[model samples]
Target: MTQFHAYQNRNPASRERYPYLLDIQSDLLGELRTTVVVPLCPADLAENMRLSHLNPSLEIDGRRYVAMTQELAGIERKRLGKTVHDLGSYREQIIASIDFLMSGI
Candidate 1:
């Protein structure tokens, strides 16, 4: 999968709060066949929190959501559903979110 491509979460149990997940893994690692994803939570829950260092707010399809960078993980390609949004424009913010998650800065 291409980096920064958003995918719809097919897991019904977790879809209500996290309807989308952003793939941060690069295409160069396609051989691994697994995607590293960051779950996106609804704005209401995200905005009321003070974890900006880890959860960065972002807009997807006009609705605001926070990228749960701390929840990053690798999952099988089949676990991801249809493409939801392409987060190419938010590349810098996404990267910064990840950097803060990893480095705490």
Candidate 2:
């Protein structure tokens, strides 16, 4: 899977946990074992949590969602399904979001 690609959570039980997930795993890791993901949440929820919002907002199947930078994880590749959309155009913002979460600066 490509970095910055967003995928829908197919698991019904865990869908509420992270309705949408962004693939932040490094492409350099060719043949990935696990996909590093950052959860995308509704704009209001993101604002409530004070998490960084994915600039321009991400559109998945015509619906807009903002990335919750602070909520990140790595899940087995097998668990992820098809690509829902890609955030490549917002690369800088996405990277900055991660940096902010990591360094708080």
Q: Write candidate 1's Cα lDDT for 1-105 as tens digits.
A: 778988999999988988998999988888786889999999887676638667767788788888988889888988998998888888888898889978878
Worst 10 residues of 1 by lDDT: 45-54
lDDT score for residue 71 of model 1: 86
| Model 1, TM vs. native | 0.91
What do the candidate models score in CA lDDT, each in turn? 0.86, 0.75
Clashes of 1: 0
Per-residue CA lDDT of model 2 for 1-105, tens digit only, reads 889998877778867756878898889984868878887776655555554433325667766677777668888877887887888987888898888777776
**How does model 2 fare in lDDT?**
0.75
Residue 88, candidate 1: Cα error in Å is 1.1
Clash pairs (backbone) in predicted model 1: none
Q: Candidate 2: where is the Cα deviation over 4 Å?
A: 53-56
- Cα RMSD (Å) per model? 1.3, 2.3
TM-score for every candidate vs. truth?
0.91, 0.82
